[model samples]
Target chain A: MTADVAVLGAGMHPWGKWGRSFVEYGTAAAREALADAGVDWCDIGSIVGADTVRGGYPGYVAGATFAKALGWQGARVASVYAACASGAQAISTARAQILSGLADVVLVVGADAAPKGFFRPAGGDRPDDPDWLRFRVLGATNPAYFGLYARRRMAVHGDTLEDFAQVKVKNAAAGALNPLARYRKRVTAEEVAASAVVADPLRLLDICATSDGGAALVLSSVDFARRHGAPDPVRIRAVSTVTPRFPNTVLDLPDIATDSAASVAPPAEPFRASIARAAYEEAGIGPEDLSLAEVYDLSTALELQWYEDLGLCGEGEAAKLLGEGATAPGGRIPVNPSGGLASFGEAVPAQAIAQVCEVTWQLRGVAGERQVAGARVGMTANQGLFGHGSSVIAVR
Target chain B: MSRKRTPVVAGWFTGDGTDGEGEADFRLLGTRCSACASVFFPREDVFCRNPGCPGGELTEVPLSRRGRIWSYTDSRYRPPAPYVSDPELEWQPCTLIAVELEAERMVVLGQGAPGVALADLAVGMEVEAVPGVLNEDTETTWTTWHWRLTGTPGSAEAEADAKGAAGVVA
Candidate 1:
């Protein structure tokens, strides 16, 4: 097999409600990434963009949108959408193009100008749609799902509200250092407690907000990197886009119910674990080799679930790890040193790419206050709505 | 005091909501195949989902109205469209609960009635599925059913019924 592609550059438009078009955010990120990689717009071989459902439709397929904004350099363009995994899908598209010799240098970008509140599907009255059904029939919201997971964790793992609050505390402390984050101010458990309850079990502080942000990356073939005068580069070792097995046990987003295990036997690993397991299998690395992790912390308790899903600790031991500070910056494995969704809120398509951005920074020893010391291997894991799973492993 | 509420969507809960009191109050829902039963909620309108064996036609089934709280949460933030929220008024958080159905063997999520609060709910508490209004406009009122936790007895039977429900999910 051909060696992995080199992550030549990573860039972002600092996340916030800038009240600008997504095209602006995406173009800015793309230009910054091109500049960082020292690659002229004309030199790039291909472009892949993660499309976000925008005003009236997915505004501008990210690739073409950015290309048009960048003045249409005539690079081969491709766009992919996988909900929250859109960025990872874009990265995967770039990797495939490079491996197939379709392009020597590729640019992958994702950006979104999110609406103010909970993300809902386009205005519709479709009974055939499960997403619409959930909202229409049950009035079930995203936080409702997050609350279900939190309550389940408490019942099964005995994870306390305090444990969930600690995740916020640790992540907020780390987020305090992330200038790119929307909420740079640190949060305390007491503050989390005092915050109004948005959903039961999860309060206002426990949930991630919606924000506008953009992230882009420049990737090139190993040979291209060597010829470009860069001796060593952070290599993208694995890009896992795994789908769930037939009998998916966990209740995921958009779906009102989980796949019934009543008929077929359940997989040894749950769907979330399988997402990370596939990445580790592809990368030839285990959780122990990871210097840090970036997980989708939609809620504080969900982050604790991810701790178990990523094999950071055994089931029911996530709270213990938190208690021991194993996931804190100075602790064993720093999880969400970019402050996670707790600080970054969420930029959907851009969020996953941003996770890789954080990993790239940490691996390069550039993550100032939240650095995981001597970091070598880092992994970013996330699951998009529907069945899309995202995991990217990078190494120095 | 009220106009009327018609179930906006059909094939969901089957019961007489307009009746002040009647036997039709018991909601008739969907049931999975006993042999190759794969649970579904919103009453699976079609066939059994089990992959391993002989397929069979689904039957109109009545799910257990009373069950225990498998889990509960709420919508702190107003959800996006298709979900109705009155922006003119300050939004209030609603209690969302997942209750295990005994005969269908799955969990269904529903909004708690007006008085239910998070403090009133806990895992393993007793809950019952009750129909509620989903949305309202001048022309129409959307009606739906949800599980509400009741701090009561018979939770063991509810759990057992959920096991028997065989896998119907919300």
Candidate 2:
């Protein structure tokens, strides 16, 4: 098993379309995390920032930017960008630093001030970039791909539109309890049906929106945590950052086509499933051991897909599991207890870090009304563009 | 006066071909790996993505004209920039289909023919490739390919439908 790193503190700026710079949100979250950890900025040996593309110049050097915003103290800095999985990458980098004995105390932060409407590629005529080609050639926006998955689920698994709407209803109810969630009011199936269709078979409410948000974590070595007066703290056991095996069959985001399976047989497990499997293997635990899960619910349908991918249920059994209330509050394996993207919308870089924060809070028994009773183990699963895997397994 | 016809992307579609008695031949162009026989759409000219096989030369090949619809959807709102469309014109929702080619064993995505609404398509319906104009101005006409419901290529009904579907770019 990999060495563990104590999660000394976790914090976030409330998720919403708050018009502000990413640096400001990140700094706010970082300060809160520092205060929670009772660790001064000057004592931190390292700072890692999840890069945001929309932040322009400062975003590219996010670690230094956050350092500057927090008052530069000459701490070692690292910046990472893996599309939506930026936060997890940031955490992975910090964990590596701690495990290698390079740093005793590390602060990881991710924040984004997202643009309104569909996320588009940077303006250019470059045909080589897959992101640009998908838009310029097919005009296949992100929702279009989500609609394809939703429709495919309806055909393959006998899922219905009602099943998809129930996901929104359940997550919305959970979000109503989360103070940091942007949409706090519970949503209903009728409201989801009444919403305008952004893409065929997917209404505006069925898909997550773009938002401005931030999340941060203060991590330290186990020895450092004990010395700092917290002998027992929420610890990250595994951070799975794997890539898709060759001949990937699933049509992932921003890709116009899947890799051809003519030359080599595709792997039996899809890319997303392998992501969770890697984490499970590294953490030496299975899905049944998980007290709760926080998955990237980019769309309500996608959440059901993640249920199966995470092995919470068998293939084509996600809807049945949801029907049994297994993924709802007070159920066997509650998901999105902190209100997933369904409630928070998406802040890209900030999202994965926020998932870990939710897991950290739940593992510590301090998640308030949304806390899972007797929670000991929690996991977060997310995938980013260009085949970046982001899943974390945490335990107290 | 004749308007100049240009491809939205060069070498992606066959140049206008006319046989005796004026029949047009159209096909989407792709590449096939010489070593592994793997097919690529939007044509991978440089290297074969198949990791098991050693590097091989990629040669141009014509893709199958017909395939089954694996899944489909439509953009209900105007997609942001890079996709060219006139803002003044009424926004017409365009259907997009992921077609699974049996021989190539790969799914290729494309815009559906105009007048083909969500009501007209099923998950496994068969669609055929056909040449269509994406957009046109006084100076040039951008030509691209569209997927239409499988029917007799030159029948009068198909011709009328193709005319209606032309220029309805995504």
Candidate 3:
């Protein structure tokens, strides 16, 4: 609401499985972003990294690790881990540093070199850790959690598998236009339906793959940006990192069951919905004012779920809105213009940062083929595991 | 000789009596919140997850001897997990059951008891939580739970082991 930080530059390593280290990807993205911002790496006052658990040690030391890889300038560094929302958290960390005047310029980086199959827990028989326990006990792969969500939708919303596949179709069609997207080929509903079922009601095509990718952003204070001969830069208005209210009733991933609604009535809005509401409130904007949104679409059905969660449409009507192509590239408010997890797969920490990078690019009108037309305002909404709020709003 | 039959998981159930050619007595292992009188399946020991109440001691608590089948589904594909499987072997569907434990007021998931048919199980059907073999290595056996549908017509297949399969929490 007050003097927010400006997004001076953004960069990314194309999303794919390269089987390399996370540091390599983050360094490359960091170099690209620094070059784009025309700011020397040494000039960056602080660095923040979004961590990836799947990527071993470097991913954990992400911020300082990437700084060391880039020939450490001794910038104050911080690393954050919030599952898929890691990148947004990294950006929020950098924003806080910038807005606090502790740093005139900040570098935010998030990258991941993911595993081949279902992301499992670190080698251990630890029954105490919920992440490990879920895998050990239920064998609920991430897709199974996605499956549970999809099934619940079918039971409650009368949503069909066809509706889910169409989301893949729409996103893939848009992905075809994104050069940075891993899978640029257009997909059909028939094709999606034919793909092997990874989980009940969700086919292989319906699920996003694990990928190795990187994204970085160069953020600066508004005063610094203006002084650097960059006037009217894209401004980051809000970063919502709110947690869920009490009486949590929804069954989230890695959990065996939902909290009992019998104890207290569940809240009207879910955690994801609250994520966007907070961002909108902070930005002094609403969904009607948005030109585009980037939501975590881990599965095709999940994208439609985000539609309701982000208040793009009322609950259970996401399927209808999607069927009408309201979320496509040319739609009224395009969702996932950066191809989403559908095309990019999941690069973990990098994905949320990548969303902000897309919004920055779109607002700057530099986004080549996948640009949202006349985009003035954009919001990237995502939720991290174990109740972490990760969403960012950028406006021109 | 064929591989020596053993419990798939170790330390889950006691009383070594086979239900058929390859089975053991069933028990669902969990921990009880000594503070709130609540129970958690898959066991919780670090701290009582109940936020409203003051911190309490947690001890290993056995779950309900029997439960009702709240919902059921089948994994047509092999689940990748602590679940061990052979890629060389042909895949067979394993029935996944969600059972509602009355005392815990929580649902636990497990494979259906051996010989329990997918068609025979239904919502609200009386079921019992029992120990089942998940897999085994030469050194260790991974034990887990299963829900055997009870009182279904022509359920003699599950009758012999029904009572013992669903173990009472000690």
Candidate 4:
């Protein structure tokens, strides 16, 4: 196994449609994380920020923006953007710096003020961008893709609409207890059924929403954690930022076509499965050892896809696992104990980092009502557009 | 007066027939790498993407006109722009299908033919690409492609014309 980075602190600005600058949310979360870690701002050796696409210039150089807002102590800064996987990439960068002894303590932060309704591409016509082409050519929104996956599950795996609703039901129940979640009211299968259909087979409630939020983490070398008087802290064991292999067969977001597999044969394992496999190999642990997981439930059906991808269940058996209550609280292995994107909606850049924060809280046995009993090992999985794959494994 | 018919993006397909009635020899165009033999849609004009193969010349090639439906869905809500549609008119949901061409072993996404509903489509059902209108303004008509089920009498005529077509639409 590779060297570990101690998660010294985890904090977040409560998720919701709070109209405010992203900088405000990120700064608040940073201060809270520093307070939680009991570390002084001047003492941090480095800072990393996951970039948001809006806000023009500042969004691109987010690290300097957060550092300047937090009163620049002249600490080293790095900014990263990988669409939805930006947060994980930031954490990965910090971990690399700590392992290489570039810095003893590093702070990672991400935040976003998302646009309402459908998230669209930037203004003007750019035919070269796939994201723009999907909308202009076919009018395929994000939910359209989710609906396609959900329908495929129904046809191939016998997954009913009820099964997809159950995922929302379970996650909303857990989210009801999470004060930080935007939609805290427990949702019912009936409510999900009554929701408007944004795309065929997938209701509005089945898909995640866009929201304004922020999440931050304070990380340090294990030796530094001990010196700071925290004898034991949750450790980040693995961060997988893998890309898809050539001839990807599945149709993913922002793409109008799958790679032609006519000449070169496709990979044995698909992209999502390969993402988890890499993390497991690096962390030296299997799905059986996971006490809980925080998977990107962009759509309920997608969450079920992650179940099979993470090796929590066999192929086409995710619905069976969900029906068995194996993925709920106090079950075989709880998935998305933080209510996932189902409860929290999506904060884009902040989400992958927030997933790590949720896993950290669960590992500490401090997740309160949503806590998994005797939680020790937790994993978070998320995928971004343009073939970016993110998954992290943390253990106490 | 008729507005000028134009391909929304250039060179992806043949013909500027935006009327959806019949484009006798319309077909989606893609590029094939000479060395690796990998085919790219939306036409990759640059170097071959296959990491294993040495870069080679990418020549434009006509993609298969017919394929089977891999999956399908419909957009009930108006998608956000650069999709040009009249806000003044009530939104009409359209079916989107991913078709798998056996020859290319690839899935291409396209809007289903006007009036084609989800009820009419099934996994592995055969469909053929045809010309359609994306949007139109006073000065120009944006032309795009649509996927319709094969065996329709209109598609049969297009298939016959495609066999003898030599010149690619500029």
Off by over 4 Å in 3: A1-3, A245-247, A261-265, B1-39, B56-81, B95-107, B114-128, B139-141, B148-170
Model 1: per-residue Cα lDDT over A1-396, one tens digit each: 236889999999989899998888888988888887888888998999999887335454778888888887789999899989999999999999998999999999999999887777666568888878788766677888898999999998899999999999988888889989998898888999999887788898999999999999999998998898767888999999999986676777777766655556678988899999989998888999999999999999999889899999999999999999899988899899999999998998899999999999899999998888999999999999889999999999
Better of 2 and 3 by TM-score: 2
Candidate 2 per-residue lDDT over residues A214-306, each given as its tens digit? 999999999999999999999999999999987888888888777777667889999999999999999999999999999999989999999
B-chain TM-score, every candidate?
0.76, 0.83, 0.73, 0.87
User: On residues B124-165, what C-alpha lDDT tens digit does candidate 3 reach at each position?
Assistant: 677765556666667645556666775543243355446546
Name the candidate, 2 or 3, with the larger lDDT value: 2
Per-model C-alpha lDDT, please?
Answer: 0.82, 0.89, 0.79, 0.92
Which one is best on TM-score?
A: 4
- The best-first sequence of candidates by DockQ reads 4, 2, 1, 3
Residue A339's lDDT in candidate 1:
95
Candidate 1: where are CA atoms >4 Å away?
A56-60, B1-5, B18-25, B31-35, B43-61, B64-66, B76-80, B85-92, B135-141, B150-170
The whole-model C-alpha lDDT of candidate 1 against the native structure comes to 0.82
- Best first by TM-score, ranked: 4, 2, 1, 3
- The reply for model 4, stretches above 4 Å from the true place, is B16-22, B157-170
Q: Provide the lDDT at B124 for model 4.
A: 78
True contacts kept of 3: 0.19
Predicted structure with the largest DockQ when compared to the true one: 4
TM-score: model 4 vs. ground truth? 0.96
Winner on lDDT between 1 and 2 is 2
lDDT of 4 by residue, B41-124 (tens): 878999889888798999999899989888898998999899888899899989999999999999999999898888898777
